[model samples]
Target chain A: GESVGLHLPTLSVQEGDNSIINCAYSNSASDYFIWYKQESGKGPQFIIDIRSNMDKRQGQRVTVLLNKTVKHLSLQIAATQPGDSAVYFCAEGSTSNDYKLSFGAGTTVTVRA
Target chain B: IAGITQAPTSQILAAGRRMTLRCTQDMRHNAMYWYRQDLGLGLRLIHYSNTAGTTGKGEVPDGYSVSRANTDDFPLTLASAVPSQTSVYFCASSVAAGVGEQFFGPGTRLTVL
Candidate 1:
């Protein structure tokens, strides 16, 4: 079955450092992708998104890079802070499924002070 | 705006019991979705509604049902809950299906004992 997956289950970054979380997807038909941050006891919140046509997209303190050839995606956080610690998930969406999203097993990012 | 609202932040139910998770969106989006988040599985789509009065099954829709009676609500029902159904359930809405961003609600955590 087509699925989205992450490279690591957990990541630790020192405060003021940069953090990167990697993900790989199995479906070539996926045209849209998104990154979400889920804090403890809270629902996932949108971080950034990119379309298949584009390779990268940037938000306030986050950047999402998509490598269609390798079916890979990554989210990079700049100047990691304590508030940035959370479970990060990458999701894929395709026209075939009406753009419905399929999420990947998350990567928990912990910002160490 | 209360982008999305879910009922009963948490629950503990015996197996074979029936449960209904209510979701409401104030954004008036045309697309609504139900997803379950497990420890290692990430978020899996359970059901979706593109508009009022229409619904569709998602990747893991078994043992679950949903209805979109109006533009503001989409409720997910479990006929006979099982232990395997214990997870955090989330409701999200988008301006339209297959495009744009999705706003999520505070999830409902269910434990089927």
Candidate 2:
């Protein structure tokens, strides 16, 4: 879906497990991608971002991998803590388009202790 | 830092009414954006301004209008409110567009009756 009005996909995982959320993008010109974590009743917080020029980038406990070949992106969260439980979103920004971002349908991560 | 502030944290409006959602950013960023969040979908851009005095329509610009006459204020106006327009609206500003991190307002939850 183009807007964030679609149903969110959900994933249930045990605490201390690894979580992987995937996103598919349609625009190949997207060069900058970022993963955001949004808790209930709050705005999205920046997680990690990767450039199309680079295949991968990592933050403290998160990693973002971009595959320009197939227009795919994935976010990996290691040691998925309960605090990490939130809606994970993948947003891509097109360098060719003055950095306008196109967001993907979010995946809700539920970490059960 | 009160980076961004949205007025009337939440509001309820009647159908066919005129309503304006206000967003302000103190970071002095050059770009401001308005997005409406629904249940499970991605954050579709309603409208964006790269700088003061300019605005552009986004994917879901219908039923919404934006104005950026100054560097600090970007208000979203709903000509005639409808139930379909009820959602949590977020205001964001970035130093630059793209992978540049965007600072978000707390968000205004609007419900149309």
**Per-residue lDDT of model 2, residues A43-92, tens digit only:** 99989888878998888988888778977788889998989889988887
lDDT of 1: 0.94
Tens-place lDDT per residue, model 1, B1-113, is 47899998999999999999999999889999999999899999999998899999899999999989899999999999999999999999999997678889999999999
- DockQ (C-alpha based) per candidate is 0.90, 0.77
Could you give candidate 2's per-residue lDDT for residues B24-72 as a string of tens digits?
9988899999999888666878999999999998778999999998999
What's each prediction's TM-score? Answer: 0.98, 0.93
- What residue runs in model 1 are displaced by over 4 Å at the alpha carbon? none
What TM-score is obtained by chain A of candidate 1? 0.98
Give per-candidate clash totals. Answer: 0, 4
DockQ of 1: 0.90
- Candidate topping DockQ: 1
Which residue segments of model 2 deviate by more than 4 Å?
A: A1-8
Candidate 1 chain A weakest lDDT stretch, 10 residues: A93-102
Worst lDDT 10-window in candidate 2 chain A = A1-10
TM-score of chain A of each: 0.98, 0.90
